[model samples]
Target: MAQHGWVTQTQNPARTADAWWRDAVIYQIYPRSFADADGDGVGDLPGITSRLRHVADLGVDAVWLSPFYTSPMADAGYDVADYRDVDPLFGTLADADALIAEAGRLGLRVIVDLVPNHTSDEHVWFREALAAGPGSPERARYLFRDGRGPDGSEPPNNWRSVFGGPGWTRVTEPDGRPGQWYLHLFDVKQPDLDWTNPQVRAEFLDVLRFWLDRGVAGFRVDVAHGLVKAEGLPDWAGEHGLLDGTVAPMWDQDGVHEIYRTWRQVLDEYPGERVLVAESWAPTPERLADYVRPDEMHTAFNFDFLETHWIAADLRESITRSLAATAAVGAPTTWVLSNHDVVRHPTRLALPQVGRRPNGIKATDPQPDEALGLRRGRAATLLMLALPGSAYLYQGEELGLPEHTTLPDEARQDPTFFRHNGEVAGRDGCRVPLPWAADEPAMGFNKTGATWLPQPESYRRYAVDRQRGVPGSTLEMYRAALRLRKELRLGRGDLSWVDDASDETVSFVTETPGGSVAVVTNLGREPVKAPAGEVLLSSGELEDGQVPTDVTVWVRQ
Candidate 1:
């Protein structure tokens, strides 16, 4: 076995089949909020290494680590300054290597987040591009434009960045001359790279090779659809001048397929089984499937389930559309109910009676016991895993941890919230530290001190240490669901919709090569009659196999 970036060779070639991510459950770990090894109040690689056993105990096949590469922390590590080294704040390259090794030892494949769409303003490539002249080769590596607006006042095009404000940022030359402008879809400090540039494409391929050679099983490509843009820099139409004074058309750009095709070629060079899961926010299933074509990504996280309203019809329609879209492309699909960037489903879908208000407002009513929210979370989890696709579980989701947004204004560390005038509260609520114990402060996530983000107070009832062995706990439910999924061979199977007498219930049947399983879920709050079958698993407070209302049931027909 050779140690390089994050990969090591296996002694037995036969172990390749055990790579396991094809139908495997993946747990997403946001490093900055996972655990603190040296008590720096921030999660580091060594801290994650120490926590690998906890993840493994959840019965997941892999751990998807969010970005921990050398960065300015502007976007909490999405802005990479150095691709090859681990940030000093999160330990060194040696620490990453150790984490990878420990994960592999625990039989958990490690997948890392790859942000190729852009880089930090302080990155060496951006620095070199700035040093190069207007027509220099280095300058061609990024999207650089000349001049001000047509009226000599604003950006060249009526394009508003995703983070609010104009997408263009003015850059000055060393001679104090206003040189040109660059495009940043999110923040001015994070400049978008020119994927059309051959050199730029080749350089990123090298970065991928650097990690693959070391032993990383795969990547979760961030903003996978934003890699390409409309060529020739055309101006968008309309008085987009009203809101941030601009609007940019962003959808289904040409030449993106070419870039992905090239990436596929590079990934094929590795001998072991590796996967590439893309994060594409395209609303339409047809467009989202484009990222997972045979030669592109292995799977694209289908986020429609995350954004859809908590209703039977909508959830059923989204699932059917996702299955059909991926099946059409002969590409596998992946499902995610929650991630670092979204509101936790447990907190998001809890009924109004549970003190969760609609429209993102805090409820003034008394909060229900945490068990009620946990029940809803478990139901959603079952729904996600039962679907015919790979599934992703956010770090604290296994414990049914809800979101935490009680941080004081001074402690709000997310740059998006601050930079965007709080138009978006940002993703800090879902990125809180993992709670390892109920008795300890900070929930044992940090032994030396507090964490970068505040730990959720509700963790006292949902910590891993307290729930791992408890019957009917969220952790146990997740383990049971995953084990049942494997025993029934749900992932590598064909799905058929079951027509229920009631519209409030969504039921589907899965037929695998080994056997078949039927899953029925009642997405409504009202009591729904159970469809007749051999019930296997339920998300209700059942004793002696009697299911309660508002339950999810898996049965064998």
Candidate 2:
């Protein structure tokens, strides 16, 4: 593959004068669950455009739409079948164009998901690869290798899927014999594309240009760290999980950076501050920083911060390290609390912090305390907003929604569930449809059809209609905080720790052009005296002059 030099000096004409993404609050919309128009039971592009008003009113700068590309819905939309067109289930290319125009009209930039690391087994290229048999150019576009056994029956290596089971699946060759195995770090339906192939590189670059020309503000690069594997399809010696940060041959290879450098050039061609946000899971903050260097990507998700336990000391340390790491590369860090993949942070924070970070907990597992979880979630949001740089808000999280932990087994849709044979419940709980109305059928998510995933009766209480403008509602808190975040210019500021805070609380000050804002969060059991400053906002009711446990307060100093 030809390597492109980093073009650091060229400025993109499409870049917004403000470079909106640099401290922007971007909302991640899981289209399938966000809103469904046309009574289709599934959310679509028009549905998202219809709800842009709500997002605009929330004061976010951009909206990152998860994959709506043509797919078999295997691994949901992550198993992309066609990068150039919208899935009928989503809508048409015209619908996406209308969406981009409508969002721009409403002052919200649009960023679409790009799954470059893999493609659906049903994708035209993958299907052709299978039909072309081993050693074909089509097969070379993906990771297909001869098995290690005498009859080539065994897999090439011992790698396992992040969803469980073997990562490689043997395919019957066109000649009718058991043949070369293909790699799928996730589901068997999603075969990892071989970045080593020039065709694959040219295809994605053109794909980026297609959307960029259609006026997408940017792309959220999925599995950005795993696009390039080590040479010779080496065997595994490290942990098999995707985001664990273990040193693995299949992840965060140096070659991936070269790919991003090429991608950066593609992004620089357009204006409007065209950006590339990475969903990378490199081992350390320092390693993660490499993805966002000036010549590489624009930003990478701070999973280190997201996966950290709900401990004040731990969170402070992670936040500190994240800021330092991004600073080293001159890039802003992006923070996210909950997304479609993980359990709602509200519920996750409420649970007892024990063992490895739990992605989701089944109803049979120890349940989180609702009150405690909501309280902590609100506090955490405030703490995140007070930091310097970008923040990605998952849909429905602003409503203080907790995970629907009791979904019936038959209703589960995540591939992880089926792959694990129901032992592990998977991520379907967090991807449930958003509630829009307290009294409307399907919570106003669908026109007259059932939601793709059942919404709990509990969701009615948290519906948008019920919470809108209600004083102290989670929705209202988020609205006010976002408005204040901009007025105080916190996003494009520098963060520094407040040295006098106790270990059980995390305190920091963001020095921005507007002013210095102090944020103090109490994660302990007792109230702590409010730091000396003018109190601006509190995630919960303050007790006298002190901040209560599981609460965060902002002050102007």
In angstroms, give how far residue 172 of model 1 lies from its true place.
Answer: 2.0
TM-scores, in order shown? 0.90, 0.96
What is candidate 2's lDDT per residue for 223-311, written digit by digit as tens? Answer: 89899888987888777545565768988898999999999998998877899999988888989999998899998999989888888
lDDT value for model 2: 0.87
Question: What ranges in model 2 sit over 4 Å off?
Answer: 1-18, 241-245
What is the Cα root-mean-square deviation between model 2 and the actual structure?
A: 6.1
Poorly placed runs, candidate 1 (over 4 Å) = 1-20, 150-152, 237-248, 351-372, 542-549
Clashing pairs in 2: 13-271, 14-271, 14-272, 14-273, 15-271, 15-272, 15-273, 16-272, 16-273
